[model samples]
Target: MKRDLELLKVILSKVEQQPQGAPFITNKDFSTRDPSLVAAHIQLLCDKHYVIAAQNGDDKWSISRITFDGYDYLDLLRESTLT
Candidate 1:
């Protein structure tokens, strides 16, 4: 769970740095046999308010926008990266 959460942070950071209406494929391929883990990581990001998760009528997740709070958090992480 710890590793998954860390990965989620990185993924969200990447998306946040991109344009507003960018398309991010949360699931890359059909071989993603572990849906539970992926969902958990996405939930963690949602709980932390890093990213917005929207489910269309087709049960597919759509990432809308990354909040300003997320950018602020990323900036703090950037400071640590320099050290």
Candidate 2:
């Protein structure tokens, strides 16, 4: 699990598009990814207030949703990517 900012952006975008406060459906809506890794990334995002994640569990396929801060972060990342 390396730091994958691009994938992080992707996750953020996916989650942000969902209804407010509703976690995105990782299994059905997004591309295939390692559940554990996605969870870890979500945790990192949570720490930054970029997303809201559930409690860590043995079930790796947990869901997360983006926040207002997340949209802001995404805009920042997008700018960085462009420049």
Candidate 3:
């Protein structure tokens, strides 16, 4: 599947909002979107070193935290959307 930058941003934002070292955020939390789609985007985020995630299955993910790069990218995304 193609990468979804918007979804990537949303995932980062959600992960950031969670408390430090909190339990992993799963696709279930993103109920509005298809779980596989969310999981795919999450895999991209993990591959990009944006978020730390563990693969639960072929189309499942458990995201734990956002990396420094993740925060930086999220900040840029937020800024770009404002103008």
Winning model by TM-score: 3
Clashes of 2: 0
Ranking by TM-score: 3, 2, 1
Taking all chains together, each candidate's TM-score versus the true structure is 0.59, 0.72, 0.89
- Ranked by TM-score, the better of candidates 2 and 3 is 3
Model 2 scores what on Cα lDDT?
A: 0.69
Q: Which stretches of candidate 1 lie over 4 Å from their true place?
A: 3-5, 29-36, 55-60, 81-83
Off by over 4 Å in 3: 81-83
Lowest summed lDDT over 10 consecutive residues: which window, candidate 3? Answer: 74-83
Candidates in order have lDDT scores of: 0.58, 0.69, 0.87
Tens digit per residue, CA lDDT, model 1, 1-83: 55453555565666676675667645332134354555566566668887777654342455666677777766666666432
Clashing residue pairs in candidate 1 (N, C-alpha, C atoms within 3 angstroms): none
State the displacement of the C-alpha of residue 50, model 3, in Å, after optimal TM-score superposition: 0.4
Error of 3 at 46 (Å): 0.8
* lDDT: worst 10-residue window of model 1: 25-34
